[model samples]
Target: MNILIAGATGKTGARLTRQLDEAGHHPVAMVRESSDTSVLPHGVETRQADLTDLADDVCEGADVVVFAAGSGGDTSEEMTDKVDRDGAKALIDRAKAKGVSRFVMLSSIGAGDPDPESDLAHYLEAKHAADEHLKASGLDYVIVRPVALTEEDGQRDMTIGDGVDPEGKAHRGDVAAVLARAVDDDLLLNRVVELESR
Candidate 1:
């Protein structure tokens, strides 16, 4: 399987690329031209493309796409909307255009119902919009909403459901493992699952 990771330079994306490699799958790191790819695993393939205006050919041979891109903490809400919402939607459209089979979105725990009064409400709103778009895209998709991310090693034991505590934490590696699993799991097709460490 040729797995394309949109934010392959990020912590979770980097971890995911390596996990996919370990699982004997090809991990294609799709990154911005300005992104530093030195952190990616050896022998991993790379494609230069920005999420905001991705070209259709970027996904030409991809079997699956994992949208892990984001506008990071320092960016404005507009940037969030552009990347997390619009950029994600663009990736979905491109995936379908390129005959990609599955899409796994790395969303946040509160993205299902964003809180208007929270400090991160804008980010959550952007993620909610992207999630909604993916749900309606008529493609095989899995929305993985993980709780607060921790740097601890992956335990590989996680609780999956909507009612899980939003405040619960999960290791980035564990989230990456789940994303890797979703890529080939037929049971996860069209499923929207929230993840948290047990």
Candidate 2:
């Protein structure tokens, strides 16, 4: 499988890129011109593309498209909308046009139903819109909604579904495992699963 991963240089995205490669899939790390590709797995293919302004060929030749990009917590709400909302929608559109098999979205837990009173309301709102866009894009999609992310190593002992702890922390590596599995796992096809480190 030729998996094109957006934000492949980020914490969780890096893990996903390596895992997919180790699993014998071709993982293409989609990055910006300034992104540091040194963090990616050795010999992993890379495609230069900016999320805020993606070209029509950004998703070309990809079997699957994984969107893991974000504007970061320190960025403003406008930036959040640019990268998380509009950017994801644009990527989804490209993937559909390119005939990608599946679209995997890395979304936060609260994105399913954002609360305006929450401190992360802006970020969640952006993710909510993006997730919705993907769902309505008429593509085979998997939305992995993970709770607060932690830097811990992947335990691989995950509790997935509504039974997962809403307030619990998810190891970044474990989340990567789920995203990688969604690439070819029919069980996760077109399903939105919540993830928690158990």
Structural similarity to truth (TM-score) of each candidate: 0.97, 0.99
lDDT of 2 by residue, 27-142 (tens): 99998989999999999999999999899999899999999888998998899999999999999999999999899999999999999999999999999999999999999999
Clashing pairs in 2: none
Worst ten in a row by lDDT for model 1: 153-162
For every model in order, what is the number of clashing pairs?
0, 0
Predicted model with the maximum lDDT: 2
lDDT values for all models? 0.91, 0.94
For model 1, the local distance difference test gives 0.91
Clashing pairs in 1: none
**Which prediction has the highest TM-score against the true structure?**
2
Q: What digit string (tens of lDDT, one per residue) describes model 1 on residues 1-198?
A: 999999999989988999999999999999887898998998899999998788878888999999988899899888998999999999999998888999999999889999999889999999999999988888899999999999775789889875678889989989998999999998888998888987
- Candidate 2 structure, TM-score to reference: 0.99
